[model samples]
Target: MTRYVMVADLRRCVGCQTCTAACKHANATPPGVQWRRVLDMEIGEYPDVRRAFVPVGCMHCADPPCMEVCPSTATRQRDDGIVTIDYDLCIGCAYCAVACPYQARYKVETPRFAYGEAPTESEAQRHEAGRIGVSTKCTFCVDRIDSGVEQGLTPGEDPEATPACVNSCIAKALHFGDLDDPDSNVSQLLAENQHFRMHEELGTGPGFYYLWDRA
Candidate 1:
């Protein structure tokens, strides 16, 4: 029972948004669609104000409301705890989008380019026709994980198997690994840090963890 999870260290995040750019480049998402994004927050009063950059996306929860509400059954969770969307089976009703508490889901009705009318060569080449009008979100780069595993690589330890966002973090604030493994990187981080998951009271059991302070 491998449960994949990501941890974001708030103390280290510098709000650079390199992870956001890497996600867009890797997924080739439309102009307005962002699968990975960092939220900037001003904490405390004006005199004691401090900025925090929180990276957010699909939590790939232990109990996903999006999965329960998908009429077309396009949203599916893998045995390894990776949530995936079958574009071929997706009907694009936006049901799953509404059910997602993390606001990670995106449904684009038409092709959109970075430019006004014309798509650059890279955008055109990477554009996914099947993704149009479908509920799409982060899969923690499952393709890379699966492919790397097939090639005898450890996901979190190997750069080739890790998620693009974690690899691209300029501040090294993001981490990904199997939560079920006590020896994993994420597990160790959680054990040594004071952390919280967003909206945990909703009972979504989100896999994304935010480390705020040392334990």
Candidate 2:
């Protein structure tokens, strides 16, 4: 029952977006396909305004709604407690996406960017050939994890093996490790913080938790 958890210290986060870049590079994600997204929420009146940035991806819920509602049975919980989906089984129905409280899934027929300069036809042809027909999301680097675990690399190891997000955090605000181990960093953080999981009222029982800044 070795389950890994991701812990973010909001108090330490400076919104550098290094994690976002790491995720993108590690996952080879295309435009409009982000496994990690930074959302900014504004609070207070215009005169006394303040902002908060929340980086969100898949919560990888314990009782994943996506798993429950996928008509094709494309999504399910792995033995390691990660939720996974089979794109070849998905029919672009968006059922699982709708079922996810976090809106964690998306289908893609063509992947392209809307921002910055567009890719050249040669680059488009190359990427499209690699991933023109597939469903995508934050796998938490499932392929990488599988490969890394085989080679004995931990989730926080960087440069050559750790997950993209964990390695790329400029502020070092993110931690990932076995939640089942009391001695693990993730476990230690949870013990010290008044942590909260997103949409806990939704009852998805997400494995992911957040250590928030004092409001």
Best by TM-score: 1
Which residue pairs in candidate 1 collide? none
| RMSD of candidates 1 onward, in order | 0.8, 2.9
- After superposing all C-alphas onto the true structure, candidate 1 shows an RMSD in angstroms of 0.8
Per-candidate Cα lDDT values, in order, are: 0.93, 0.74
User: Global lDDT for candidate 2?
Assistant: 0.74
**Candidate 2 lDDT by residue in tens digits, 77-112:** 887778887766766677777888887676667657
Tens-digit per-residue lDDT, 161-198, candidate 1: 99999999988899999999999999999999999999
Alpha-carbon TM-score of each model against the true structure: 0.98, 0.86
Off by over 4 Å in 2: 46-48, 113-134, 157-161, 213-215
